[model samples]
Target: MSATQTAPAAASPSPASAPVKNSRGRVILASLIGTTVEFYDFYAYATAAVLVFPVLFFPTGDPLTAQLASFGVFGAAMIARPLGAVVFGHFGDKHGRKATLVASLLTMGIATFIIGLLPTYAQIGWFAALALLILRLAQGFALGGEWSGAALVATENAPAGKRAWYGTFPQLGAPIGFIIANGLFLVINFSSPSREWFLEWGWRVPFLFSAVMVIIGLWVRLKLVESSAFEKASTKGAIRKVPIGTVFRHHWKELILGTFFMLATYVLFYLMTSYTLAWGIKPADVETAQAAADAAGTPFDAAAFFPGGGFAYPEFVTMQIIGVVFFGVFTMLSGPIADAIGRRRLLIWVTLAIIVFGLTFNVFLMSGGSPRFAGALAQAFLIFGFTLMGATFGPMGALLPELFPTNVRYTGSAVSYNVSSILGAAVAPLIALALWAWVGEPWLVGVYLSVMGVLTLIALIIGKETKDVDYEEAGFSSSAVL
Candidate 1:
């Protein structure tokens, strides 16, 4: 008998049996919590890179170079993601989603905790920077494995006819994590006495708090059962022999489509989060070093005077944190909206909005006014941009898994998602930094979003719509031979 024929009937459950209260809800909760913790760890680094790292790790005399170096470290995680996807996805397909989900969370938590404890550049010289880099790469590896398992958990447990709607649950982690990550920093920024006080201790609080989030994520994930589809695949020995190779050999087209389709989403994310924070600092009234100089009576050059060592101003940190909360609110609304409207249609519209908004973000920053007004504009832009991101990002939970078959779905979806991370999301801040420095005009960064948006549009136009497709029957078949 074929491997497909060897499993219990639950392996092929109909839509009615897969209701939200059944196995479906348990799987969605597990996947959502796991991804939330992973993103919390990952995005916390992005927040730190913008607000603290240039002062802490790379203390070059030139502010621009130091900031770029900080962003370079931020980009390192994306570069490591694809490699992680292959390694973890291979095992996830062969072993199961539960194992990979658990391992990825533990790895991310350990790396993030180490980041909280690392000695400053002053204490260990170059070693502090080295430690941060190693930890960032580990975070990347963990994230790489994270999405595949989370997505599979949702897709596999979803009701047959409404998988797209349920699968989107894991995707909610992006915005929810964004909310918690930024909200914690906002609290820290507001609580500090002087900007100097904030830079010295405020930034570390968010990274340190990650231990609690990971614990919660682990507890929830531990309760999850193995995905019904994967359980069946394992019983029959139909899991891809060499998953990545199998994907590359047989389904390269879908992989490529998935990569481009995801590019606009990723780029817009980094632009809104990391790039927006960078722009806010360079142009706003807050002296990144004002707090240290006020107390020390020395002219504080931020690149020369790292935080944890000291800071220049404090009020501005609160403003930035407020802006992040706006981002979180929009993310919360995206999942259900995508379920209501198809993923493809929503993504196309949102891609266009990002292209337009990316350009407008710089315009608002460059236009002069009281710092308060600029802060308001910044908040509005971030909220609006993240709103569109939520809309399209909502659907990807279902869309990716629906693109591939059960046998190699884990591997294929992972490659597609991580490859998009490397190409679009991971490199975005670095690209934005380079463009801003190279031309002295941040608007050019919008051009980057526009190009990717156009590509996403084209890809979606040519792609299949999986809104109603049966999960078991999605994507192409893998031949028994590799």
Candidate 2:
């Protein structure tokens, strides 16, 4: 059957029938709160991996090598995400969305809290790195399950004609989480009397504070009922015994299309946040700066001549926070726009915008001559890149869930979302770093991003527009054999 076909009469709900609702506000709140905590935990680790983990976790060596190793640990979480999806997706589809959401939250929160207490290399040698790896994997695993459940909860309970808007509630978590995570680090970066103190102990505060956030998230999530859609499926005996297997056997096309459709968004997100942090804070290359100055017959001022020297960590993060505000705003706006235009159309236009942004993104970064200029350029990149990110990411919560039947929605969506992380987000920073080091060309990274955009644009062209699809009926009449 075609993806856009209506469900047959025996299984599908009538178009005139009202959608069942437990509480729309409660569902959106539960999804938003849980996702905010999940992303907060994830972003905290990303920030630390860039700023502190190299010095604290790895052997003293070339800073570049150590930074790569830290990112490798970061990628470890992304690698484990798919496995988490499979495990949690099984229970989420077989049992219920509520219980699965609660379990994933606890797993992520405990792992983040433990990371705060872990010993550094000086204290425990290689064992410290090993322990860090284990905790990071736990985090990835939990997040694997968290996002799909949150998206489903919001979309499934959403009123007819408003799934995209409701879906943005969960998408809202990305910027909010980034702001909280970076805001905390910014506080620690300035509050400490010395850099050593900040690196050694101050960084732990955010990770440790995750314990409180997790409790709050759980409280909010626990208050939610299972999604109305899932409840309906269960009542009708539509719930699958092995959701993952069913997804692979029946929805493989959507699984592949969804993964590639999200590739550019993931790539752009990590590059903007993680790789930008790495690039901005790296120490000035004095030799290279001197060469350029001598060749131009201008006196070398270390601050003005080197790109890295011009960027201060606190100031850069503050700029990112400002940009993230716009990201959140646009994220909210993208939903209504998708409702009006269509998810596929909105995605195509925004993705094309990303390709344009990617081609010129390096120009802004390379144009930094003074501290003021550098800060302005950084802000420009963040605002522009994140605007596109918001538009592309906002509709995803609705789009992915709409792609599959209700019986396999959680498993299909979770696997597609997490599997993309492995292909895109898991190694994006690592790949960008390698490109920066090997070719010493920032535009190459832009080209790389554009390539991902092209892939996603193609996926969009080949995929159906799902904004008008009836979520209530799409999943109930699947043809897959048991």
Candidate 3:
């Protein structure tokens, strides 16, 4: 009797008898598919904001004014994200991750699909821009909850010692979604009979097509069981009556640290995707830009204009896609490296590298003396920037949520992540454009990125390492922790 041992938890557990565990594949698919749809919808809107929305929705007679207006609408969504975070996080932290994720996906998908159907400024006057703003806010709201849920679903379910590695699955969605969305846009651009028709009808395809991906994501996510960490928190009666209140009262320091931890990532990501596209694709010479404006029937004011790097849309997109391939690869690579070392240690080095990289933007971008030379420099810049993007971004999937305890993980992480979105993502493109025009080059934009990185590094130095934190560790039950 003294030597007899009780059976392990799995000794008598069968598929039907035991608790429903989220399999690796199911967890990966659920997290990956949700964010894929989320980012795809986001990137499609971002691309359209740069390419079509300025002309179709703003139509302000001045290219820069119209572009700035479009970015204003774009930034509106970021403003709504924290609200979405609070609402969604309340449900997620108290109820479960699966339902919150499904709700977010549905919200984003429907908003995007409706955007495809909205009338342009040419047809509905300013109402069209108003409708676009509303829909963009909905997208932002859905995304606020979507990311934290997905990251938690992945990392909380991960086997011991592999949270960072598993976290990359959802992070992978960024590059995959970007490629698919942009690839489809490129196809529409090539296949359309006329530029006018493409501008009018083709831009709607990606937004409308989000419906299909949303359906697929729903199917995958519906199969997910609530994560074990959430179950344990619930079992221990640690589920707070209001999770965000607990987070604010007890975890305020982590909340601040997590927000800045993500500041550089948001700034760098938007700069790479949105700012660079606007900066790289415009003609550097006024004559070509004016001629292009004339061909498109858009009004141009050459006397007050500043031109861009002069790369054709297809050439630049191909270059960006190539760089994004590096983005996807390095994203996968960063996980193991972070896991093998530690998230804090690896990101410190990457942050320093980002700081250095940002200082050198003028070397590649401003030195485009000849067409051939310019193309090479631009492509190199895209590659290096996006490579840094992947490395910095991949770790965030684990880093942000790990800052909080299980009971308030969703609320804390979402608030932190989305609040940073307001500071960084919402304003990066607009600020970059103004800086590019004011200073007459892209160097200030690079300095903008470096400053953000420096802030992020300072936060990292102040914050503690999250790699050693246990996802399933006991959570606070309306209690204080030092």
On TM-score, the candidate that comes out on top is: 3
Query: What is the TM-score of candidate 2?
Result: 0.89
- lDDT for position 183 in model 3: 90
How far does residue 203 in candidate 3 sit from its true spot (Å)?
0.5
Itemize residue pairs with steric clashes in candidate 1. Answer: 55-306, 195-313, 195-314, 289-312, 290-312, 291-312, 291-313, 292-311
Worst 10 residues of 2 by lDDT: 300-309
Alpha-carbon error at 343 in model 2, in Å? 0.3
Instruction: Identify the candidate with maximal lDDT.
Output: 3
| Displacement of the residue 6 alpha carbon in candidate 2, Å | 44
Choose 1 or 3, whichever is better by lDDT: 3
lDDT (tens digit, per residue) of candidate 2 on 268-371 = 98998888887776443445433433443333243331234246678778878888898899999999998889899999999999989989966887844886
- Residue 387 of model 1, lDDT score: 70
- Per residue, candidate 3 scores C-alpha lDDT tens digits across 317-429 of 78888999999998889999989998988899999989988888788788458899999999999999899989999999998888888999999999999999999999998
Model 2 segments beyond 4 Å from truth? 1-21, 282-309, 474-482
Q: Least accurate stretch of 10 residues (summed lDDT) in model 1? A: 304-313
In model 3, which runs have C-alpha deviations exceeding 4 angstroms?
Answer: 1-15, 283-306, 477-482
